[model samples]
Target: MTVREIATEAYRESVPVLVLSAVGGLFAGVVLGGWTPETEQVAGLLVLVPALLATRGNVYGSLGGRLGSALHQGLVDPTLSLADERVNAAVAASLANGVLVSMLSAVLAVGLLTALGRPSAPLATLVAIALLAGVVSGLILTVVVVSVVFVGYRRGLNPDTLAGPVVTTTGDVVGVATLLVATRIVLALGGG
Candidate 1:
Protein backbone atom coordinates (compact mmCIF):
# COMPACT_ATOMS: atom_id res chain seq x y z
CA MET A 1 0.00 0.00 0.00
CA THR A 2 1.12 3.55 -0.68
CA VAL A 3 1.89 5.90 2.21
CA ARG A 4 -1.20 7.93 1.45
CA GLU A 5 -3.36 4.83 1.48
CA ILE A 6 -1.91 3.73 4.82
CA ALA A 7 -2.45 7.16 6.31
CA THR A 8 -5.99 7.33 5.05
CA GLU A 9 -6.79 3.88 6.38
CA ALA A 10 -5.38 4.70 9.80
CA TYR A 11 -7.20 8.00 10.01
CA ARG A 12 -10.45 6.42 8.94
CA GLU A 13 -10.18 3.69 11.55
CA SER A 14 -8.96 5.83 14.44
CA VAL A 15 -10.78 9.12 14.12
CA PRO A 16 -14.18 7.79 15.09
CA VAL A 17 -12.83 5.94 18.07
CA LEU A 18 -10.89 9.01 19.17
CA VAL A 19 -13.99 11.15 18.99
CA LEU A 20 -15.91 8.61 21.05
CA SER A 21 -13.10 8.49 23.57
CA ALA A 22 -13.18 12.25 24.00
CA VAL A 23 -16.90 12.12 24.67
CA GLY A 24 -16.46 9.29 27.10
CA GLY A 25 -13.75 11.23 28.90
CA LEU A 26 -16.07 14.17 29.27
CA PHE A 27 -18.71 11.89 30.72
CA ALA A 28 -16.24 10.53 33.19
CA GLY A 29 -15.27 14.03 34.16
CA VAL A 30 -18.90 14.97 34.74
CA VAL A 31 -19.43 11.99 36.97
CA LEU A 32 -16.33 12.78 38.93
CA GLY A 33 -17.17 16.45 39.28
CA GLY A 34 -20.62 15.51 40.56
CA TRP A 35 -19.08 13.41 43.30
CA THR A 36 -17.97 16.37 45.37
CA PRO A 37 -19.66 15.12 48.50
CA GLU A 38 -17.87 11.79 48.39
CA THR A 39 -14.60 13.46 47.63
CA GLU A 40 -14.98 15.77 50.56
CA GLN A 41 -15.96 13.02 52.93
CA VAL A 42 -13.07 10.79 52.07
CA ALA A 43 -9.81 12.57 52.67
CA GLY A 44 -7.06 11.91 50.13
CA LEU A 45 -9.59 10.20 47.87
CA LEU A 46 -8.64 12.57 45.09
CA VAL A 47 -5.08 11.44 45.37
CA LEU A 48 -6.15 7.90 44.72
CA VAL A 49 -8.36 8.76 41.78
CA PRO A 50 -5.73 9.46 39.16
CA ALA A 51 -3.53 6.65 40.39
CA LEU A 52 -6.34 4.12 40.27
CA LEU A 53 -7.57 5.14 36.86
CA ALA A 54 -4.08 5.29 35.41
CA THR A 55 -3.30 1.85 36.74
CA ARG A 56 -6.39 0.42 35.08
CA GLY A 57 -5.53 2.04 31.78
CA ASN A 58 -1.93 0.95 31.96
CA VAL A 59 -2.62 -2.64 32.92
CA TYR A 60 -5.63 -3.24 30.73
CA GLY A 61 -4.22 -1.24 27.85
CA SER A 62 -1.19 -3.47 27.89
CA LEU A 63 -3.47 -6.47 27.98
CA GLY A 64 -5.29 -5.15 24.95
CA GLY A 65 -2.04 -4.56 23.11
CA ARG A 66 -0.83 -8.04 23.89
CA LEU A 67 -4.09 -9.51 22.69
CA GLY A 68 -3.95 -7.44 19.53
CA SER A 69 -0.44 -8.65 18.82
CA ALA A 70 -1.50 -12.20 19.49
CA LEU A 71 -4.40 -11.90 17.12
CA HIS A 72 -2.10 -10.52 14.45
CA GLN A 73 0.38 -13.32 15.03
CA GLY A 74 -2.35 -15.97 15.13
CA LEU A 75 -1.24 -17.01 18.56
CA VAL A 76 -4.81 -16.66 19.79
CA ASP A 77 -8.14 -16.71 18.03
CA PRO A 78 -10.37 -13.65 17.90
CA THR A 79 -12.85 -15.16 20.30
CA LEU A 80 -13.35 -15.06 24.03
CA SER A 81 -13.26 -18.54 25.46
CA LEU A 82 -11.85 -20.46 28.38
CA ALA A 83 -10.22 -22.86 25.97
CA ASP A 84 -7.86 -20.08 24.93
CA GLU A 85 -5.20 -20.51 27.54
CA ARG A 86 -3.13 -17.59 26.27
CA VAL A 87 -6.04 -15.22 26.52
CA ASN A 88 -6.95 -16.52 29.94
CA ALA A 89 -3.40 -16.19 31.16
CA ALA A 90 -3.03 -12.65 29.85
CA VAL A 91 -6.28 -11.59 31.52
CA ALA A 92 -5.37 -13.25 34.80
CA ALA A 93 -2.03 -11.52 34.86
CA SER A 94 -3.56 -8.15 34.13
CA LEU A 95 -6.11 -8.57 36.90
CA ALA A 96 -3.47 -9.56 39.39
CA ASN A 97 -1.33 -6.60 38.50
CA GLY A 98 -4.24 -4.20 38.59
CA VAL A 99 -5.36 -5.28 42.04
CA LEU A 100 -1.89 -5.33 43.48
CA VAL A 101 -1.00 -1.91 42.12
CA SER A 102 -4.30 -0.51 43.37
CA MET A 103 -3.63 -1.63 46.90
CA LEU A 104 -0.16 -0.20 46.69
CA SER A 105 -1.47 3.10 45.47
CA ALA A 106 -3.75 3.37 48.48
CA VAL A 107 -0.90 2.68 50.83
CA LEU A 108 1.32 5.12 49.05
CA ALA A 109 -1.33 7.79 49.04
CA VAL A 110 -1.89 7.43 52.75
CA GLY A 111 1.79 7.44 53.43
CA LEU A 112 2.37 10.49 51.30
CA LEU A 113 -0.44 12.40 52.97
CA THR A 114 0.73 11.50 56.43
CA ALA A 115 4.27 12.45 55.59
CA LEU A 116 3.10 15.82 54.36
CA GLY A 117 1.05 16.30 57.55
CA ARG A 118 -2.15 16.19 55.56
CA PRO A 119 -5.29 14.57 56.84
CA SER A 120 -6.08 11.24 55.29
CA ALA A 121 -8.64 8.55 55.87
CA PRO A 122 -7.55 5.52 57.79
CA LEU A 123 -5.16 3.24 55.96
CA ALA A 124 -7.52 0.31 56.19
CA THR A 125 -10.39 2.32 54.77
CA LEU A 126 -8.37 3.50 51.79
CA VAL A 127 -7.02 0.02 51.18
CA ALA A 128 -10.50 -1.51 51.31
CA ILE A 129 -11.87 1.04 48.89
CA ALA A 130 -8.97 0.56 46.52
CA LEU A 131 -9.21 -3.23 46.66
CA LEU A 132 -12.94 -3.26 45.98
CA ALA A 133 -12.70 -0.77 43.15
CA GLY A 134 -9.74 -2.57 41.66
CA VAL A 135 -11.43 -5.95 41.52
CA VAL A 136 -14.65 -4.62 40.01
CA SER A 137 -12.98 -2.38 37.47
CA GLY A 138 -10.37 -4.96 36.58
CA LEU A 139 -13.00 -7.55 35.74
CA ILE A 140 -14.99 -5.07 33.70
CA LEU A 141 -11.93 -3.77 31.86
CA THR A 142 -10.64 -7.25 31.07
CA VAL A 143 -13.87 -8.15 29.33
CA VAL A 144 -14.12 -4.83 27.54
CA VAL A 145 -10.52 -4.68 26.30
CA VAL A 146 -10.62 -8.27 25.17
CA SER A 147 -13.93 -7.90 23.39
CA VAL A 148 -13.00 -4.66 21.63
CA VAL A 149 -9.60 -5.86 20.50
CA PHE A 150 -10.92 -9.20 19.30
CA VAL A 151 -13.98 -7.83 17.59
CA GLY A 152 -12.13 -4.96 15.97
CA TYR A 153 -9.52 -7.34 14.68
CA ARG A 154 -12.22 -9.60 13.28
CA ARG A 155 -13.77 -6.64 11.51
CA GLY A 156 -10.45 -5.95 9.74
CA LEU A 157 -9.76 -2.83 11.76
CA ASN A 158 -6.38 -2.31 13.28
CA PRO A 159 -6.59 -3.43 16.89
CA ASP A 160 -3.40 -1.51 17.60
CA THR A 161 -5.18 1.76 16.91
CA LEU A 162 -8.34 0.74 18.73
CA ALA A 163 -6.96 -0.70 21.96
CA GLY A 164 -5.27 2.31 23.58
CA PRO A 165 -8.03 4.88 23.23
CA VAL A 166 -10.78 2.40 23.98
CA VAL A 167 -9.08 1.06 27.07
CA THR A 168 -8.11 4.50 28.38
CA THR A 169 -11.57 6.02 28.00
CA THR A 170 -13.39 2.97 29.28
CA GLY A 171 -10.98 2.67 32.15
CA ASP A 172 -11.56 6.26 33.19
CA VAL A 173 -15.33 5.97 33.12
CA VAL A 174 -15.51 2.60 34.83
CA GLY A 175 -12.76 3.42 37.27
CA VAL A 176 -14.52 6.52 38.53
CA ALA A 177 -17.88 4.78 38.79
CA THR A 178 -16.46 1.80 40.62
CA LEU A 179 -14.43 4.01 42.94
CA LEU A 180 -17.55 5.91 43.89
CA VAL A 181 -19.43 2.72 44.53
CA ALA A 182 -16.61 1.31 46.60
CA THR A 183 -16.35 4.48 48.63
CA ARG A 184 -20.08 4.43 49.28
CA ILE A 185 -19.91 0.83 50.36
CA VAL A 186 -17.07 1.52 52.75
CA LEU A 187 -18.84 4.54 54.21
CA ALA A 188 -22.09 2.62 54.61
CA LEU A 189 -20.18 -0.04 56.48
CA GLY A 190 -18.80 2.65 58.81
CA GLY A 191 -15.32 1.95 57.58
CA GLY A 192 -14.50 5.34 56.10
Candidate 2:
Protein backbone atom coordinates (compact mmCIF):
# COMPACT_ATOMS: atom_id res chain seq x y z
CA MET A 1 0.00 0.00 0.00
CA THR A 2 1.10 3.57 -0.63
CA VAL A 3 1.84 5.89 2.30
CA ARG A 4 -1.52 7.60 2.09
CA GLU A 5 -3.33 4.29 1.88
CA ILE A 6 -1.42 2.91 4.86
CA ALA A 7 -2.11 6.00 6.93
CA THR A 8 -5.80 5.86 6.06
CA GLU A 9 -5.97 2.19 6.89
CA ALA A 10 -4.23 2.78 10.21
CA TYR A 11 -6.65 5.53 11.04
CA ARG A 12 -9.58 3.30 10.22
CA GLU A 13 -8.24 0.43 12.24
CA SER A 14 -7.54 2.68 15.23
CA VAL A 15 -11.17 3.66 15.65
CA PRO A 16 -12.45 0.35 17.02
CA VAL A 17 -9.47 -0.20 19.28
CA LEU A 18 -9.78 3.29 20.67
CA VAL A 19 -13.46 2.66 21.41
CA LEU A 20 -12.60 -0.60 23.12
CA SER A 21 -9.80 1.06 25.06
CA ALA A 22 -12.20 3.64 26.43
CA VAL A 23 -14.66 0.96 27.47
CA GLY A 24 -11.94 -1.17 28.97
CA GLY A 25 -10.51 1.84 30.79
CA LEU A 26 -13.91 2.44 32.36
CA PHE A 27 -13.86 -1.09 33.70
CA ALA A 28 -10.34 -0.60 34.95
CA GLY A 29 -11.48 2.51 36.78
CA VAL A 30 -14.09 0.47 38.56
CA VAL A 31 -11.49 -2.09 39.49
CA LEU A 32 -9.26 0.66 40.82
CA GLY A 33 -12.11 1.94 42.93
CA GLY A 34 -12.44 -1.46 44.49
CA TRP A 35 -8.71 -1.44 45.10
CA THR A 36 -8.94 1.38 47.60
CA PRO A 37 -9.15 -0.85 50.63
CA GLU A 38 -6.37 -3.10 49.45
CA THR A 39 -4.12 -0.17 48.78
CA GLU A 40 -4.76 1.11 52.26
CA GLN A 41 -3.78 -2.21 53.69
CA VAL A 42 -0.48 -2.24 51.91
CA ALA A 43 0.52 1.38 51.61
CA GLY A 44 3.24 0.74 49.07
CA LEU A 45 0.86 -1.07 46.76
CA LEU A 46 -0.49 2.37 45.97
CA VAL A 47 2.93 3.52 44.90
CA LEU A 48 3.43 0.50 42.69
CA VAL A 49 0.28 1.04 40.62
CA PRO A 50 1.59 3.57 38.13
CA ALA A 51 4.82 1.76 37.70
CA LEU A 52 3.03 -1.50 36.97
CA LEU A 53 0.77 0.15 34.43
CA ALA A 54 3.70 1.86 32.77
CA THR A 55 5.59 -1.39 32.52
CA ARG A 56 2.63 -3.07 30.88
CA GLY A 57 2.13 -0.30 28.38
CA ASN A 58 5.80 0.03 27.64
CA VAL A 59 6.44 -3.67 27.18
CA TYR A 60 3.30 -5.17 25.68
CA GLY A 61 2.24 -2.07 23.84
CA SER A 62 5.66 -1.90 22.27
CA LEU A 63 5.42 -5.55 21.44
CA GLY A 64 2.37 -4.79 19.36
CA GLY A 65 4.21 -2.03 17.57
CA ARG A 66 7.16 -4.29 16.86
CA LEU A 67 4.89 -7.03 15.57
CA GLY A 68 3.22 -4.60 13.23
CA SER A 69 6.57 -3.40 11.97
CA ALA A 70 7.71 -6.95 11.46
CA LEU A 71 4.62 -7.79 9.48
CA HIS A 72 5.08 -4.73 7.34
CA GLN A 73 8.71 -5.67 6.75
CA GLY A 74 7.85 -9.30 6.13
CA LEU A 75 10.31 -10.33 8.82
CA VAL A 76 7.51 -12.16 10.56
CA ASP A 77 5.19 -14.23 8.43
CA PRO A 78 1.62 -13.01 8.15
CA THR A 79 0.56 -16.18 9.93
CA LEU A 80 0.01 -16.24 13.72
CA SER A 81 2.52 -18.95 14.42
CA LEU A 82 5.83 -18.66 16.29
CA ALA A 83 7.31 -20.79 13.55
CA ASP A 84 8.98 -17.68 12.30
CA GLU A 85 12.24 -16.93 14.12
CA ARG A 86 11.36 -13.25 14.26
CA VAL A 87 8.05 -13.95 15.95
CA ASN A 88 9.70 -16.23 18.48
CA ALA A 89 12.37 -13.68 19.29
CA ALA A 90 9.88 -10.88 19.65
CA VAL A 91 7.61 -12.88 21.91
CA ALA A 92 10.45 -13.96 24.14
CA ALA A 93 11.76 -10.42 24.36
CA SER A 94 8.34 -9.04 25.20
CA LEU A 95 7.80 -11.59 27.97
CA ALA A 96 11.18 -10.91 29.47
CA ASN A 97 10.69 -7.17 29.25
CA GLY A 98 7.28 -7.44 30.91
CA VAL A 99 8.54 -9.32 33.94
CA LEU A 100 11.87 -7.58 34.43
CA VAL A 101 10.66 -4.07 33.85
CA SER A 102 7.82 -4.56 36.33
CA MET A 103 10.18 -5.79 39.00
CA LEU A 104 12.52 -2.87 38.48
CA SER A 105 9.60 -0.48 38.53
CA ALA A 106 8.55 -1.84 41.87
CA VAL A 107 11.98 -1.18 43.26
CA LEU A 108 11.91 2.31 41.82
CA ALA A 109 8.53 2.94 43.38
CA VAL A 110 9.80 1.89 46.75
CA GLY A 111 12.85 4.07 46.40
CA LEU A 112 10.80 7.03 45.37
CA LEU A 113 8.45 6.65 48.28
CA THR A 114 11.35 6.31 50.65
CA ALA A 115 13.07 9.37 49.28
CA LEU A 116 9.92 11.32 49.96
CA GLY A 117 9.63 9.80 53.44
CA ARG A 118 6.28 8.31 52.52
CA PRO A 119 5.09 5.13 54.15
CA SER A 120 5.20 2.22 51.76
CA ALA A 121 5.33 -1.52 51.73
CA PRO A 122 8.67 -3.27 52.09
CA LEU A 123 10.73 -3.71 48.96
CA ALA A 124 10.32 -7.47 49.06
CA THR A 125 6.54 -7.38 49.14
CA LEU A 126 6.39 -4.74 46.44
CA VAL A 127 8.75 -6.71 44.27
CA ALA A 128 6.75 -9.89 44.77
CA ILE A 129 3.44 -8.34 43.86
CA ALA A 130 4.85 -6.51 40.86
CA LEU A 131 6.47 -9.63 39.46
CA LEU A 132 3.48 -11.84 40.00
CA ALA A 133 0.97 -9.36 38.66
CA GLY A 134 3.24 -8.56 35.76
CA VAL A 135 3.45 -12.21 34.79
CA VAL A 136 -0.30 -12.73 34.94
CA SER A 137 -1.11 -9.58 33.03
CA GLY A 138 1.69 -10.15 30.58
CA LEU A 139 0.59 -13.67 29.75
CA ILE A 140 -2.98 -12.56 29.15
CA LEU A 141 -1.86 -9.59 27.05
CA THR A 142 0.51 -11.64 24.91
CA VAL A 143 -2.22 -13.93 23.67
CA VAL A 144 -4.74 -11.16 23.22
CA VAL A 145 -2.31 -8.82 21.46
CA VAL A 146 -1.06 -11.52 19.12
CA SER A 147 -4.55 -12.66 18.28
CA VAL A 148 -5.79 -9.15 17.67
CA VAL A 149 -2.85 -8.37 15.42
CA PHE A 150 -3.45 -11.45 13.32
CA VAL A 151 -7.19 -10.88 13.24
CA GLY A 152 -6.67 -7.33 12.09
CA TYR A 153 -4.27 -8.49 9.40
CA ARG A 154 -6.65 -11.19 8.17
CA ARG A 155 -9.43 -8.63 8.03
CA GLY A 156 -7.33 -6.34 5.85
CA LEU A 157 -6.69 -3.98 8.73
CA ASN A 158 -3.44 -2.50 9.96
CA PRO A 159 -2.22 -4.20 13.09
CA ASP A 160 -0.24 -1.09 14.02
CA THR A 161 -3.37 0.91 14.72
CA LEU A 162 -5.25 -1.78 16.60
CA ALA A 163 -2.59 -3.48 18.69
CA GLY A 164 -1.31 -0.64 20.89
CA PRO A 165 -4.69 0.67 21.98
CA VAL A 166 -6.15 -2.77 22.54
CA VAL A 167 -3.15 -4.14 24.37
CA THR A 168 -2.81 -1.10 26.59
CA THR A 169 -6.48 -1.16 27.50
CA THR A 170 -6.26 -4.83 28.29
CA GLY A 171 -3.11 -4.17 30.28
CA ASP A 172 -4.96 -1.65 32.37
CA VAL A 173 -7.77 -4.02 33.26
CA VAL A 174 -5.80 -7.22 33.59
CA GLY A 175 -2.89 -5.49 35.29
CA VAL A 176 -5.08 -3.99 38.01
CA ALA A 177 -7.05 -7.17 38.52
CA THR A 178 -3.93 -9.29 38.74
CA LEU A 179 -2.24 -6.79 41.05
CA LEU A 180 -5.25 -6.91 43.35
CA VAL A 181 -5.06 -10.67 43.45
CA ALA A 182 -1.34 -10.57 44.13
CA THR A 183 -1.82 -8.04 46.92
CA ARG A 184 -4.40 -10.22 48.58
CA ILE A 185 -2.08 -13.14 48.37
CA VAL A 186 0.69 -11.12 49.98
CA LEU A 187 -1.65 -9.92 52.70
CA ALA A 188 -2.71 -13.46 53.39
CA LEU A 189 0.87 -14.59 53.67
CA GLY A 190 2.22 -11.73 55.78
CA GLY A 191 -0.78 -9.74 57.00
CA GLY A 192 -0.08 -6.79 54.69
Q: Highest lDDT: which candidate?
A: 1
In candidate 1, the residue pairs with backbone N, CA or C atoms under 3 Å apart (3 or more residues apart, or in different chains) clash, namely: none
Cα error, candidate 1, residue 58 (Å): 0.5
lDDT of 1 by residue, 45-162 (tens): 9999999999999999999999999999999977666799999899999999999999999999999999999999999999999999999999999989988998899899999999
| Model 2 TM | 0.91
TM-score to native of every candidate shown: 0.98, 0.91
Error of 1 at 52 (Å): 0.6
TM-score of structure candidate 1: 0.98
Candidate 2, overall lDDT? 0.85
Name the lDDT value of residue 114 in candidate 2.
93
Q: How many backbone clashes does candidate 2 have?
A: 0
